[model samples]
Target: MTTAVFAGVDVEVNEEGFLVNSDEWTADVAEAIAADSGVGPLTELHWKVITFCREDAAREGTAPGLRRISKLSGVGMKDLYALFPKGPGKLAAMVSGLPKPQSCI
Candidate 1:
């Protein structure tokens, strides 16, 4: 485990920098994570995906992948790719402060 300071709060993280505890997640932390991801900034659309990823992870015991996030998040694949860049599911899951999906690349 590693300690990552975000929003002036220290939170635990995995070797990959994904949050270790969902309880440590905050909107401020999300924004910091998003910023650190080089995704520019967190827009409304970005928030939507972040919220969806967190909620889905809470219910499903794992963060949803790109396919599910695109299908159920009310955000399209093109936009997700554009907003998150690189990998939508992976980045969003990281920013949402959930466990990196076992399937994320």
Candidate 2:
């Protein structure tokens, strides 16, 4: 684990940089993480996906898969790819401050 400062808060992250505690996540933290990940300054559309991922993770006790994120978040697959290039599922989880999805490689 590594301690990182985001939004002036110190939080732990794994080797892959995923948050160790989802409870410590905030919009400011997300902004910092996003910028670090080269994903943002997050847009309103990004916020929609991030908010959906956080809420869904809280309800399910795990991060949602890309298919779930696309279907439920009202963000289509193409748009998800456009919004979070490289790997949408993994990147979305990272930016949303949730643990990496089990389905992610």
Candidate 3:
């Protein structure tokens, strides 16, 4: 794993690490995730979804399902998949240093 310090936080991540600081994720970290994910700038919609996922995971102790993410962000499955082509969006969110999601293992 590789580590980067952001906002006085030590963020450790893997190659596809996008959600490493889910607990204290910021726009800069989100940008890092987008860049690492090979995506362009994250839209407000993307930030909304990621933020919701992080908050929900922190509160509920598990990564929110696609249905819940969609409900919270008003983003559809297709769009979510397009944004997060990888299987686990939650992982990406975690790698971004957002926080520890609820259902993370």
Candidate 4:
């Protein structure tokens, strides 16, 4: 793990950049992370996914996969791809300050 500063907020993160402590997450941190991950200037749709991921991870103790995220958020897989690019499940988890989903590569 390593320490990172996002929008001036210091927090610990894993090698892949997922937050070590979910409690350390904030909107500023999310924005910074999104920017760093090439998904910046989060739109309302992005917030919807991010919020759902964070809440679902808090309840499930693990990040949700793309299927769950797509079904639950009512955002189709294609949209998720457009919103996150390359890897939606992993990228969403990272931006949400959650660990990478087990279903992700």
Candidate 5:
């Protein structure tokens, strides 16, 4: 798990939560997420999907599944699977500094 402050707000996350933000996120925030998620070398596409997942989770209070992520990011499930082969894409998204899921609480 990793943590960072985005928009002057503190964000805590691990591998089992949802993405949260106190405000609309920016590219800098996404970079921070990538650094925290243990994917410091994340590509632009990775940032896009990860950010989308975080925002969606924050809005819905639930982590978006791979299918939703694919839809929002315009990335295929197979491609997402290749990126997160461990089957915890949501967790990875959380680790990138998303909010904790309601279920987690």
Candidate 6:
């Protein structure tokens, strides 16, 4: 485990930089993590995905997958790629302060 200073808050992270403890997450931490993940700034649309992912993680113990984010969160695949870059599933989960889902790979 490693510690990352997100939004000035030190939190535990795994080798891939995803949070080790989801309970330590906060909106500010998510913003900082998003910026670090190359999202730069969180927009309304970005917030939509983040909110959905966090909520889903809380309810389901994991962030929704890419297709779920696209279909349920209404972000679409292209827009999710544009917003999160790289892989939307991993990036969105990292930004949402949850561990990366197994399906990301």
In angstroms, give how far residue 68 of model 2 lies from its true place.
0.6
Tens-digit lDDT track of model 3 for 1-105: 688664455666655554443555677766765665566677776676767776776787766766667666677878887777764455445533544334423
Taking every candidate in turn, the Cα RMSD to the unseen true structure, in Å, is 1.4, 1.3, 4.0, 1.3, 5.1, 1.4
Query: In lDDT terms, how accurate is model 6?
Result: 0.87
Q: How high is the CA lDDT of each candidate model?
A: 0.87, 0.91, 0.61, 0.90, 0.58, 0.87
| Pairs in clash, predicted candidate 4 | none
lDDT of 4 at 104: 49
Q: After superposition, how far is residue 49 of candidate 2 from its true place, in Å?
A: 0.3
Error of 5 at 75 (Å): 1.0
lDDT of 3: 0.61
- Estimated TM-score for each candidate: 0.93, 0.95, 0.64, 0.94, 0.54, 0.92
lDDT per residue (tens digit) for residues 1-105 in model 2: 999999899999999999999988989999999988888689999999999999999899999999999889999999999998868878899999999899652
lDDT of 4 by residue, 1-105 (tens): 899999998999999899999899999999999999898689999999999998888888889999999989878889999999858978999999998899743
lDDT of 3 at 29: 65
Error of 5 at 42 (Å): 1.0
Mark the regions of model 2 whose C-alpha exceeds 4 Å error after superposition: none
User: Once superposed on the true structure, which residue ranges of model 1 sit more than 4 Å away at CA?
Assistant: none
Candidate 5 local Cα displacement, residue 62, angstroms = 2.1
Better of 2 and 4 by lDDT: 2
Best first by lDDT, ranked: 2, 4, 1, 6, 3, 5
Model 1 residue 12 CA deviation (Å) reads 0.4
For residue 43, model 1's alpha carbon misses the true position, in angstroms, by 0.2
